[model samples]
Target: MPVNRTVNVSVVFNCVQNGANDFGGSATYTQSSSTPSDLGNVVDSNGNIDLRQASAYDPSQYNDSVDFVFTLAPQSTGYVTPVVWASRNGAGATIVVPQGGNAQEFQVEQSSATPQLLTIVDNDDDSNTYNYKPAVELPNFDHYYISLDPRIVNKPSSTNK
Candidate 1:
């Protein structure tokens, strides 16, 4: 099987933007920690976080790997998408190594209409440069059972982004 080498990241002017038939109103696409992306072992090591995994992962483990977090108020996506969630490392917690920490997380917005086409966006630009890329492949990415879904989001997921 081939491996994911590059993840294309982009920003969203608005989730419920006046595009895609005004698929805008206030919508967001996200996957729970159960999804491979959140716990998946597809770290980029040198580049930004794997775009594929980021798109797949929900806020479940989001706080676990990133330093700062910022999300613009829901845009005009016009669809009531589900809320994807995971066990984030929690706020004010110091990030450790080996197990990874929130300091490595990246911020990216995506489209539930096409989960597979999930895009990466950076609304916050403090000390944040890029989403945290895994230094190695997360075992969860390849193996199942390593992590399970927390059943947070109720919306239907799109294809793999």
Candidate 2:
């Protein structure tokens, strides 16, 4: 698709009009690998694409343009196949992190006013383990730290900080 987007995009899932509810599928997309990246968390279980999670960039730079080819795979063989129900384009937002300040005081905020960046300087600092978390979470937070980038950032504190 010729997508000229810079914000979060979503694919609405629903049963086909012909009552082909038996067939369901997940959505995913692919991007260039010329730059270092990992797309482990960008995809939804119900087949949705978030272009931001498909690539990486320096905290101060814009995301590298990506060409996402959305794909759908049917869950089971049925008389009817899955079809697009609806799609919503994204309205881009900006992330602002304070520069040259106390790293501990600064934080990375999402489009909404929420800070989800959590940093564990050392295992001795807390009982929580970082083994289960991915190497890097989405919504880059290097712009907030003084010495190191966040290992687990952009995670809602209310959910798990």
Candidate 3:
């Protein structure tokens, strides 16, 4: 027998200008399959993506897993392209990681457009830094998810260095 498969993938950028402020513009792109077709029908002028999961997931129903979160910030204006890779214990959560809480959560941010690529590298590897490697693989009977957020960090209150 032979195996063939086609994966239809899409990404939605929840764009914002500065901390939590709306961009006051709209983005035209296809939303991820995790979202419904009719729901993500509009990317409002406020730069808000309408695609949202209607139901809540029960964490207790699955095994231990990591939730990768990527927040991208662009220097100026250009189409934003993002990528994601997953692995076990690949990265750290600088904001919220309780002493023994869910170490499964990890977060990273790309503050400038200069660094066009964001790669997750494990501590063990020392070569080929550009490689997009996942520290862990999908676990059996476990649930995992990725949260991609695009926002601008520059605000009027920012100071020049």
**Which candidate leads in lDDT?**
1
- How would you encode candidate 1's per-residue C-alpha lDDT over 89-121 as one tens digit per residue? 221112223333443333333343443233222
Task: Report lDDT (Cα) of residue 45, candidate 1.
Answer: 20
Give candidate 2's root-mean-square deviation (CA, Å): 16.6
Error of 1 at 29 (Å): 22
Off-target runs (Cα >4 Å) in candidate 2 are 1-35, 50-64, 81-161
Comparing candidate 1 with candidate 2, which one achieves the higher lDDT?
Answer: 1
What are the Cα lDDT values of the candidates? 0.26, 0.25, 0.24
Q: Which structure among the candidates has the greatest TM-score?
A: 2
Summing lDDT over every window of 10 consecutive residues in candidate 3, give the lowest-scoring window.
152-161
Q: What lDDT tens digits, residue by residue, belong to model 3 across residues 1-161?
A: 21111111232333333333223222233323222222223222222222121122232442212112222233234322232222332331122222334222222433234232232211211111111211111222131222222321111111120
Worst 10 residues of 1 by lDDT: 144-153
- Count of clashes, each model: 31, 1, 4
